[model samples]
Target chain A: MADWDWDFTWEILPRLLAATVNTLLAAGIGYIIAMFLGLAFALAQRTPSNTLTMAVREAVEFIRSTPLVLQIFFVFYVGPEFGVVLSPWVAGMIAIGLHYAAYLSEVYRGGLENVPQGQWEAATSLNLSTARTYFRIIIPQALPPSIAGMGNYLVGIFKDTPVLSVIGVAELMQTANSIGSENYRYLEPYTMVGIIFLLISLPSAALLRSFDAWVRRKLGMN
Target chain B: MSYFEFLVAHGDLLLSGTLVTAMLAAVSIALAIVLALTAGLMRLAPAGPVRWVATVYIEFFRGTSLLVQLYWIFFVLPLFGLSLDKFTAGFIGVGMNLGAYGAELVRGAILSVPKGQWEAALAINMSPLTRMRRIILPQALVIMLPPWGNLLIELLKGTALVSLISVADLTFQAKQINATTFMSAKAFGTALIIYYVMARFIITPLMRWLERSMARKLGRA
Candidate 1:
């Protein structure tokens, strides 16, 4: 029985904070990948080709239903068997990015759906290409409504970044695990991980909610 | 195929692991339902310590990662002499996390049950508890089921983390078999399909049925 150790906590704070940067980088890179992939998925599902739509829809559903931790393992562990070996960081980012992309595609689908038939018709009437319609007219309108859901998943991807620790990503959770194993003091490191997540995620969630409202107002949709 | 041979060899282990995963999902989801209702009610309580406590629980559980929480409860609580087996810690970690999210859905559903219903119950001189029991809760339950279905799936996925705690769930079994056989594709692939089946064929349809039955019972079908 050891009591709470402040001295040990101070010694470990810098190490934990240093690893927080890696965690942020992993999440940041993963979020960007998800954003692009999710939009592609959302668009793929809406294409005129029924087969493509069905395939993409099934892909998204399969991804969403399965556990992300397993997906991370699959990508990292199984990739080598197919001669598609990737580092832990690369595999982790792809797996998590793919998992959240499934969720984000749904969010995008909802936003894209909310854009009226009139917008499409008007673009057609104006003789605009599909690309011009999406880029110049529709996507901007779709974006404001999507912002809140997108932000939630952004926070979601961050929370899920810890799963990457399993693959030796050296992110916050993995770093904390090493610290605990090294010092044999699980309490401080684990508790601090929880605290760091709360401190980062809570305010960001709040900010995103307000930002969503602001965007909606700015777009005159609300 | 090599995968079929692998399965033929290790099918029993995978089957047992699937059973463990199912058990974990069922127990944790049950716990989550109870906790969600309790906290949801507490959240709607007029401003006070109860509401404050519920809010804090929801925020803390929702804000942090479940893996971190599971590690804390399983790894740290023993230091304070409150040791729990992996299953106990596993379900608690997931149940609490899901409950926090479910609490919001519960509150939202209850609040969504139009204002007039509460006013009407008040006009009829119904007690508050009776109003909730007889009037509000029944309606709110139907509204909440679809979202609760999603949460249940999330709970099922989250149980994978219990493997990290060495719970011998489907994921752990897959990992173990992989270590020995070095057949990562077959092991993890089978595990993924089993999970997908559980989610889509089992949990999703089951939830859809419940939602429909509840709607019919409430005369809203």
Candidate 2:
């Protein structure tokens, strides 16, 4: 068995921890963008005009079907060609956010579908405006069931932050890669990154599960 | 160069890369299914130690990022006098990662098989191994196939990550062409379309067929 070197792990612990902050920030901002944009896309698909709805649906499907890493490379590399230069950080966030938005839109669509038809009829009978009906009747009920799905993706995006390393985002994975390349010892660095991810994901997963259970109970679901 | 001219010139390279990507995804998923089935069954084992081992394997692999795992297997293991080729390492890393996820699906499907079925198998005096092999596993396979198909598509997309470790898959080939021609649009654009076609034309149809066949078999029974 190979004896792990504790001194090396201890020395690099702070650096990994520091990079983890960037990872968390990226996940936070990306998730926020995804949440809002996902709603926009989902709403766009349900727009009154058939042409607008079809175009939006196709665009979302295309984005959803492609690999996120390739999307990141495309946005990061192609943006400058189109006279829209973005830094690696911005590019990474946009790519991750857009990719996840396509997914979250589906979640939102499912949540919206779960809203019973009678609720909309009741809102109509009350002479509510379309916007008011959506805000007061539909969205309030649709949002909660989708919370668990959204939370899962939050953890997913957190886990996928390492992919941003391909664009040199200086997140935990990038930091580990550079450290390994410089020192020629990947054991400590990669293992440290794995530990850091477990530290975050395992706890978040447990919390999400409990939250899911609590939500189910609140909804009177078994 | 025009996008058309660039694509025409580099068409052969892109095609070969696409072929490699498909082959890698197919092979890795085949291996992953076998691993997942075994580990997943072990997860439901009556023995406490067996279940613990399976849980540890799944959590440890699923919790970490695939990129880190790929780098470790491809780059780090050699330091400890255990070395694998780049292609082997890529396959192992992706297979293990997907296996961790697939195992959960397998376990869920198995458990979803009604308790009455288990009781029936036991009442018939079937051995535990025979019951699983003849009854539980067959039903679980049908239930597991649809989700496994989705995971297979995910695995296909994931193979692009192998390029980072020098596997020369589709993404790597596109990067190579882009570097030489500086036609990022054509190179990457072609790669993306190829992936889309594979997923839409091939994987999706195959999954539908599997779902139909499984449904038919269940109905016949």
**Cα error of candidate 1 at position B215, Å:** 1.1
Q: Candidate 1 regions off by >4 Å?
A: none
Tens-digit lDDT string for candidate 1 (A20-112): 999999999999999999999999999999999999999999999999999999999998888888999999999999998999999999989
Error of 2 at A58 (Å): 2.7
Best by TM-score: 1
In TM-score terms, candidate 2 sits at 0.96
Per-residue lDDT value at B110 in model 2: 95
Would you estimate the TM-scores of all the predictions? 0.99, 0.96
lDDT of each: 0.94, 0.88
User: Which 10-residue span in candidate 1 chain B carries the lowest summed lDDT?
Assistant: B1-10
Candidate 1 differs from the real structure by a C-alpha RMSD in angstroms, to one decimal, of 1.0
Q: What docking grade applies to model 1?
A: high
Over the full model, what C-alpha lDDT does candidate 1 score relative to the true structure? 0.94
